[model samples]
Target: MALLILTMVRTGEGSINSLGAGGLITLEERDTLIAFQDFSFDTDGWDRAIQENSLPGLGPVLDGSVDTAVERVFALPEETALATIRFDMFLNGGWGREDTIHIILGEIQTLALGWPSDNSELVTFARDGLSVLAQSALLDPIRDNHRVARYSVELAVSFPADRLTLRLVPELVDGAQSNWAIDNVSVVARGPEA
Candidate 1:
């Protein structure tokens, strides 16, 4: 006789709404999820300098460039219940140990603690209303530079609203050269699983 093992998987049925070029979304169902992805500087919805860079096979990554400060506004559809949101953050030039990055959704803080004092790889926060899925450090060994590290965060939404505002505030200890960039922003709304 032979021993056998089995595993189980579950999948939920829901709708997904993604943000368009103008940061617009249309609602479908009560559990409809929305996500925003901006890879080009052609959109005027974003209020900042959008930079373009080419990769080997990944093509171009149009990023929301922010030297000192910048902000992006997003509006949600009605009859939608938000569940999670996420985005990718990049440190272009270089960042200092004292450099701080604040991720705010509406008026709630999504980052863990305050600013990083020592050089660390990644940081995750466990908090209510919102939670940090992942955060990268300012140092990179393969790039041989302190910059060029990509940080990403995912948050669980407890408060839902019609108009959702997401802002990335970076307090750089260094000069203007140390800039922060963001791209591939997404928001999802879902109902409680059955």
Candidate 2:
């Protein structure tokens, strides 16, 4: 069997409205599912930096340049059973005085089949609307020399197979500054049969 490609959209230029319209596949039935691979963010200069040194009280600074970004890759069907999300990230760059990376899994939304309407909205991974699936922090005060800081996280969701959406946000911590980069961002789904 082959892997299903869900959505391959990029965020950062501005706010994106619908997941399916942004390249995400809409779910038709409860058993619908998809997966993602080679998710990336490459900037030309300092202009595309999402948030450099945006976090306070955190060590290291973030620099926003073409070399600074986030990358992640994941196989959903392999790590998850029934409905799971998995990803591996690589953060490369130099930390100045106070810069850090804030990796977040954005809200999840339920959409109709074919994504007929712009029913997509910012939602929570948890039903309580409080807890989130996964999040992480990257600090580089020592200037790891862009050594590919690696991270991975997995989540178990209760929503229907095809009606789920995932989002990621990377930001700088504190007012610090440094150059950051990312690569290999992916999201996949796994079921009992897989």
Candidate 3:
């Protein structure tokens, strides 16, 4: 039998706050990836308002205090293995109805034991419903009313591989916008496949 160990290789790291925009966050090295505030509405009438409130401003928003980025270490053959990802993310910004966040595993490109792959394959997990833990009531700026406050979500992802690309996406669910923060992303490599 082949013995495998799920170990963490990268954790508590983030990008240089220089790359943030579009609907993607790609990291060349083992760093924390931040999603730039880039969302749109169906109507142009709310363009200005949305841009001001939704754009994920530039800075070290996570700052290690909010999120920890972790990499996984697997003990398997060079080609076959499993990886598990866990994100202990927290929302520390002000409360608003329009705030939302998600941790996404894009795809696996290479099967090597290290990261920084040239090309990768994409795969998505199953998202059935809102995996929420807590909810509060907060003020809504756009609607000018009270909205459901923001909270945190502990997400886990299991896949078969060593190297892959992932991203964190946070958005404003309600018309009233607010900032969202993430912390502690733990990634581990599972044992060999059966």
Candidate 4:
């Protein structure tokens, strides 16, 4: 299936109040739970470890020690036709801006996203087998214990697979200072239509 993802570049401009209205979805009784991680307790087997006192109000977040990739794998339901993975991307410290960001899913589906130009809209292109629908919330200040950008991301899945992998790959500027993390992640899917 064609993987779709998008996001805004700046904070509070075209924002949706992360974890508030238009935020992440709450799991209902009817839905099948795939996975959820907020990093409030532990890393929960994620490649990155939980960094305490990373940001205020947001207790702990996954701090990437390895520069390779921050990834998580989930067992998907083959019976379902679609799935939605929602989470937030924290661009912390003093990092340089990029022209684009990529979110890889299941190792096959990928969504390439671009930053907003002069307008309020976040830029994206239909590259390869990807599409975008941008939505973003507030960003943090670039300081110690501050996050430069926090984007609430949602990936719409349209195909079935034995399992799905979600990956956030970042190329660091000053690896020692500039950092990244993901929080309040959850995956939910719908069954095939009759």
Q: Give the candidate number with the greatest TM-score.
A: 4
Native-to-model Cα distance after best TM-score fit, residue 167 in candidate 3, in Å = 0.9
Over the stretch 21-111, how does candidate 1's per-residue lDDT look in tens digits?
1123334455555545545434345566455652212223445444444555666665544566665566655555666667777787666
Write the candidate numbers in order of decreasing lDDT: 4, 1, 2, 3
TM-score of each: 0.64, 0.36, 0.35, 0.70
lDDT of each: 0.51, 0.34, 0.29, 0.56
Q: Is candidate 1 or candidate 2 better by lDDT?
A: 1
Q: How well is each residue in 64-182 modelled by candidate 2, as lDDT tens digits? A: 35334332233233333445444433345433333444433334432111101222223235453223333233333334333223333344564233444443333445423333433
Per-residue lDDT, model 3, residue 162, is 44
Error of 3 at 32 (Å): 20
Question: For candidate 3, lDDT tens digit of each residue in 62-180?
Answer: 32111223222323224423333333233334434444444444442111111111222122234432121221223233233322222222223333444444454444444232444
Task: Mark the regions of model 4 whose C-alpha exceeds 4 Å error after superposition.
Answer: 1-30, 98-101, 112-131, 138-142, 145-147, 173-176
Deviation of model 1 at 14, angstroms: 29
1-194: candidate 4 lDDT, tens digit per residue: 01111112211243455333122355555467676666655666565555565655555666654365767777876686667677766656655445234678766546543333322334344444334444543454535645455666666666657577887666554444556666667778767666
Better of 1 and 3 by TM-score: 1
What TM-score does model 1 achieve against the real structure? 0.64
Ranking by TM-score: 4, 1, 2, 3
TM-score of predicted model 4?
A: 0.70
Whole-model lDDT for model 2 versus the true structure? 0.34
